[model samples]
Target: MKYMKWPVLLGILFIHAVAAAQVPVVTLGPDFAEPGDGWDKLMQLKNGNTFYLHFSRKEGLVVNVYNAGHELTVTDTVHAQLWNTADIESTEIDGIFEINGQPVLFLQQLVKYNPVLYRLVLDGVSGKLVREDKLGELPSVQFRSVFVDDNLASHDFYVEKDPESDYYAVALFSGMPVQKTDSIHERIQVMHFSPRHELLHQGWLYMPDTTYSYFSYINMAVNGKEKVYLGTVGFNTKRNGSEIKPKVIFSALSPDSATFAHQVLDYTAGFANVGGTIQVATSTANVYMLLHVPAKQGEGNSSIILNTFQLSTGKLQKHVQLVFPELARNMEMNLGYKDTYKGTPQRFMLNQDGTSTLLLENFSFFKQGNTQINKLHTNLGDIGIALLDTAGKENTTMAVSKYQVITGICEPFQLQRRSKSEWMFRNKIAALNTNTYLSYDYIPGQSAAFVLFNDYLQYLDTGGQDRVRKPLKYAVDANFVCYRFYNGKMERLFLFGMPEVTKGYACMMGAADYNAAVGTYATLLISRKGLEKKANIAWIKF
Candidate 1:
């Protein structure tokens, strides 16, 4: 006897309708110009009402801040004292967030030598420097990333005052420690600092073994409580003198950042040199860990795995694996086995619902008669988004709109989802054959606005494939997009373009927020081309 239920099916449809009603509409508008040179980073603030841009120029580094409504508010310049040589080290915008209810920006300046971290406070309206401070020296060691959390109330410099401190502003460094025996050894240290600029605690990560290790990414989450998550790579040397057998370790910090707990999430017993990158959301639902495992020893064939850990359980209970078997079919395609190689499968995103996505960027084949005329092997890179149900089932696979087969160096691709069924994709926007980076905003009812570097300015459909608008060539090196609502109509906001010294590279990094009254956006740009100088800061108003 078979039974059929109609009421249950009807209830599902009714619930879906309610969900759809809650999703916001996205609208896009015509492009406008806001200008600068050698732009690099962007940040949105005041709920998406203001924008900050930074860039570098031959003369020095420059910054421009503007309103999302297409108004220029503040422009400031910082001269780089070390621009004698052409080769310059990379610089990064460390953190931009509110501290004590006031807006502050932290810039991490790295030259060829040791790194120096600088802190600058910005007046919310004009983007002027309210105050400035230089933090501390980083022992000439390499750093993977830096973050600022307002919840870290204790400073690292004053740890002796209280051994049971709950919060400490921290800096993570990756490199080898100087040895008295004149031998180099790898080490990772977390330098904790107080809110008023004091060192509290500094120590090496005590691992179970003597294997060389490095820290890559830091994920900080703020809920009713605060938590810090770290991703690490562990490797051991083989008897043949070659490094082999790598593993990934996941570590978590207590709510107060006083104690540490860790576990081996993935064991690289079969795969060699496995590593991962992790990111935690502002909401502490889950942690996204992107794991990379090479297929062979010192070979290029590799797979990307996305693992999700339930914070409550502190265990990896879900994973999505992506493999490319075609790499094994060709021998000449082999390259030095490393995680940074282009065209390898790279894990992109891990959504809130436990769905994960990965990006395949490069394609290669065996060289034949002519290197240029060889049978072109289309990589046909793919994006996969999967949902892991609470029952631990891989139940759904979300459809990803395909991307075009782009040649030459491509910028890091960006992905955003508007709804359960809709997603957006765009690579770093740059010049022809030159790697390009792009910054964008996706409004549900509005269109997706992307700012690219190349001489050409362009727009793509939601799928990131169809060209909705033709290329508008501009002399600026970087650009960003913001969304504004006026009289019930949504509009796209554009900022001035800054010239970049690197052909296809731009320093523009930005973010946005939306609420009831207004939407605020901000971008940071370096106005110069070379690395030996500090970039200026620009704040945009919308």
Candidate 2:
């Protein structure tokens, strides 16, 4: 309930400094000795043990177990005959989770563009293989990025387990055929698995009909009750050819595959002028959708439309158009001009009492090039927060001031022009309570690019006259800040000064996860050394 300003007080500064000093850095194994491509994943088990998992077809799957003190205790490798195929180059590892006190690794191998999934469970202490089973597969499916979904709308492979029931399911989707010969087709394959990795039920669900000419975006989520929900937004060509009408559809598939329900959300009638992005979020009992609809009659501003659905009965519960007077004021005050609503929902935090927090980033693109060549930048304009209570009413709306610029190259390895430096502000937010959240900002500050290029703009502005732009230098200023939010207000907790990370150590935080059992925050880092890379997990305990 108390507020603290930035440049925090002396007592608050001491608290932050102490927490920063307790951060732990764990290094993985030595560099690769073989000449093959591989990836590593870090996972924490249920029994308070951690493991660094690395696998390559040539070397098989290896597990390096670390104790509570972050010391490596065991190293185990499994070289099964299943990975001896010739098409090993098309193999992909999804993720690692636990089953019956053993670590199970999920892998997908592509055979002629189709996918075959395999599950292998390893012993915790000895790293020996406990069981190896071939799960299911979807033929003729394409794979996308597992780390980041770049497509505006696409399906992702999900492997989830029900904690209470100890049951699991795998959902895989194959895109429609390039040549549309059929109107409706089976597009999704869902497989239910037991705790021992045995396939229980398999079903195929058909996607809604769409023309071959029209492009569609689809996203899916599975609930704890073993139900799969699909939310799709497509633009179909009208008969008069005057304009393309937006269509939105929702589908639900039950666990036994006996009951399938489909509902049309009045795509053409309700959202005749709406078209941007449709993001879907699901709690245990409800499905929520946030649509960035075009506000103006033709093309002036945008509006956020929130729709809630009952997951059990597949019924539309409520639909409300959210108003953001505070966000408009924040944009006008910070950017000196007001733009349309461009909030892209990234994180949806749901509570037990049915309240949800929708965190959005005002996203836009920047073109930085002259008449000759151009590059696109993903500009993070600002941050927006919306809270929806149990009644599906948006009770509060708040916008935070934050601007970020993303470049093409990963700044940890490559260098660009000094004028076009790659600035990064890494942060993470986690729910502290039903109505409060905490965000940690770890900005080891900006660095000037090592290279310079002034020809792109100079050629367009001066008719190819000047080439030199400015001298280049490397610079960095590191610091960290924390913020607490509750009831439509934000308070700066404290800011701590920090030493810069040495070269080859990519201090940029890739991901953050909270360990509920330990009550600590863990940050994942991708550290590179020339051609080799290491996975470092930093634990921040206060």
Candidate 3:
């Protein structure tokens, strides 16, 4: 009788967990298995279709399209010979974006050091490849993907899709000539394409002076109103200084004009350097930037600077300089090499109610959304979130704690003793191993935001038992977990039960996507059975 009561109570708890707490609808797609060493990207389309694109050296490219019922409708292979070659170098899924109510596949791959992009058009209902074309002038300078061995490949490529319409833009960095004192930079080709994948204009992106020496692409947006905007960061070559300054270069290219509208912003009053990542975005008529600058002359920790500017008229809208005093890290003690509490903005997500939020992360080595709209993602970090309000100038930075460390030559301890050169080495080293299992992705909400990642199985149980002595399980042995945030607090939980050794699954946390209107968070699941592996699409909804 006691056992029967326990089974009934367990069933009731499971039902309540599904209906009350975050309910997960983990529906694995059809049994589509692939050989080892491949990549998968799950995209939730606007027209209620989900496309799962998979690629490998052995399978070439296989795409599975699913309908709104989460039923697999079509499976087709594109570029069959492209990935089957032996000398293939760098390959990446640029993403499947909707153009003119149709799903268009964007891919970048290099064969024998030659880089090129592919634009594939699929039938909306059939999911068959309707068209395929090579995009841009292959950067003669041998530009490979970002995670490739060395950036010495000399070229960089990224695709930007317009949120307001089907228009998209491709900016291909051909190569930079020998740096000159008088010239900015050269060979950057910007091509604007229509929703139907038609080329509208092809021109050069006017860059800033080379004195800064370092340039990082921030964001790109194509406004439905005939304006295409690009944002970037240009910082000085100062390893350490109070006068260390970083600048924001916002350039707008229009079909009506032959030249670019440039706004070069250097906040001399607020001092910052290349101490962290710079995030900037282009709204309908304005450009916003968020960064963590080195603390003031005598201060110990870093500060946050948010700049909002009118895009067309080049007028300053709002300049919010944020300083977190209570949580200061006294970073001035470490020659800017060590950051005890990170303030660098990793993500800038625009909210629905005319407001935005910037997510910052730190590691001690553990701690821890946005649009505007670049389809870009950061590596791994702990967590710090900054919420900006437009109605009231009330701003708040919330810090959440979690223990995580991406193990490799790019381990966290090495970052403590390394110089700037060694720091840059870890930056590239992260790209070398490409641990898709180590990162976190979030589903931003109005009332509460949900953060998801992989962690140990013991993390599933939060009975206050000490986990300090427990062995850590990561990479393939990790379990999918979430940090659900609400009311200024976070509740962490595991998404699925603990997996056994031979039969288990690994959630590609980096490949996850969310649909707010649909109330679903989607990602690709890699399930293993004995020696066989399978790739399936999984969706979780609240």
Candidate 4:
């Protein structure tokens, strides 16, 4: 079972007790756990159908489907014999698809790097499995879908439904089988399937050369029906075991054939400098690539290179370099290379009004220990904005200075660490307007209304805990302050206060989703009393 311990809530209730007077819009559910309670998975379908699933050691998996009106629609179960086969102990439902206007569940059980998938077609009205089949195995990589030999991929696998083609695309990176070779080359497999779970196209791409033993760092962007750009930035280690500057390669899917339109961009022609990180973005008609390269060999300040390509012609549309002002005044620690001035382009969005925006977040990681368990502390500091015209030319550049830190104890194979940190800031951002976005900070409830970027000294000095390890307490109150980002600026927005509910009531923000049908955001959590667990929901309308 995934348990959440509220350590910060004690400080929150003592400091912001007055702010707890406001009532929040919320709803609670009855007890759903039966004896042996495990982890719960929440999902929202494309057609606005939502459900919460719970797995048990004896009873299998229980799914409770809900409509947009927050009403329970159906309850169904999939037996453990169907999923817990052979050596696999866990089963994950990748997606629930409505193929030919009927519902089907896509499940997978991972045995090492590969996944054994299953498709269970369900009767729409009754929520009963009409038919089931093993969809066979596909080649896949473990580290967040992208081909990250360096293990820096932030997200997991990439799975999406093409709006125009009505086809599903899935991609993952994995090592080659032992029988294939003992080489260091990684395999990137892209699979296409029909909405009815029919396999359409299966293709694989291999690393071109061994010069980049640590190659295949990938970031992808999809446009329309026919285009899926898989971009990679890898360091060349061919020269005497020394890591060199990163190079880029793009593999765009060709709809007509089972091949990719590969393109290579060289950043080492002019200088011998090294590139830091790379990101890719796409719109309906264009694809953009952003690369961060160090300004000078020893200088810590980094510069960005933007390369835009036309989707139709596959031609380079624009190339530009940008250098922004240091927004590190808000950064907590201004010392060392890890906390130095470095920028990473985080988001790119094409608006309905024909304008596009690029959002960049300041990032740094500090290594506390030499071990694997508690080594690095990640920090998200300040935001930078760049507005672009239709042709992908930069119009203006601005910066938003706000510091946020993510530091907590994450023990492997422990329930205390699973849902605790993952759910705290699940839905961190909400759109307020075309040019405005809002982000919530979780520290306003602690009397100090400031953003607490986790300090490395604090963590090391405290012997690897956030503050001090104490007994786990179940908290009911959640307080947050909103920060508004508009036209490249950041300002605090005191919209309203969070709910001050009783104990045993908390929001399972890990399962949050924005319901367009109801114009509200909802999440499910649990109220725990000793060994008893009950499912509850909290919704907020914006």
lDDT of each: 0.37, 0.45, 0.53, 0.44
Q: Tens digit of lDDT per residue, candidate 1, span 380-412? A: 232222224432233322222222332232222
* Superposed Cα deviation of residue 507, candidate 3 (Å): 1.3
Instruction: Compute the lDDT of residue 141 as modeled in candidate 3.
Output: 45
Which one wins on TM-score?
3
Candidate 4 or 1, higher lDDT: 4
Instruction: TM-score winner between 2 and 4, please give it.
Output: 2
Candidate 2's TM-score reads 0.62
* C-alpha TM-scores of all predictions: 0.53, 0.62, 0.72, 0.60
10 residues in a row with least lDDT, candidate 3:
1-10
Candidate rank order under TM-score: 3, 2, 4, 1
Candidate 4 per-residue C-alpha lDDT over 1-542 given as tens digits, one digit per residue, 9 for 90 to 100:
11111121222212232332322244444445432333354555555556665544445666777776766788877553445533224455455545554455566776566666666665544556677876556455453333223333222233445433356666654433323353443345677777666676766544455434433434454454456666655444333364554556666776675656666566533232223222233334556665544443134334656677777656666666654333332222221123434556544444434355555555556676665644554454454445566554556444334343333231111111121111121111121010001121221111212121111111211211122332111122222233322222223322222233232334443344544345445555444455545655545543
The residue-by-residue lDDT of candidate 3 on 1-542, one tens digit each, is 00000010111113233223454556666666643455556677777888776555566667778998889888877653333223223555555676776777666666555567777787776777778788854544442232211112126676777655788888776444334442344446678898878888866665443434444565566765477777655443333232445565667787876555667766633233323221224434455555444444224434655666665665567667654432332222211213345544555566535477555555322222142212233334345555567531335444443334554422221211111001111122223223556545656665556767665554334211133523233455566666665554445544555466676667775556677677887777766667877777788875
User: What lDDT does candidate 3 reach at residue 373?
Assistant: 19
Indicate the residue-level lDDT of 126 in model 2: 68
For model 4, how big is the CA root-mean-square deviation? 10.5
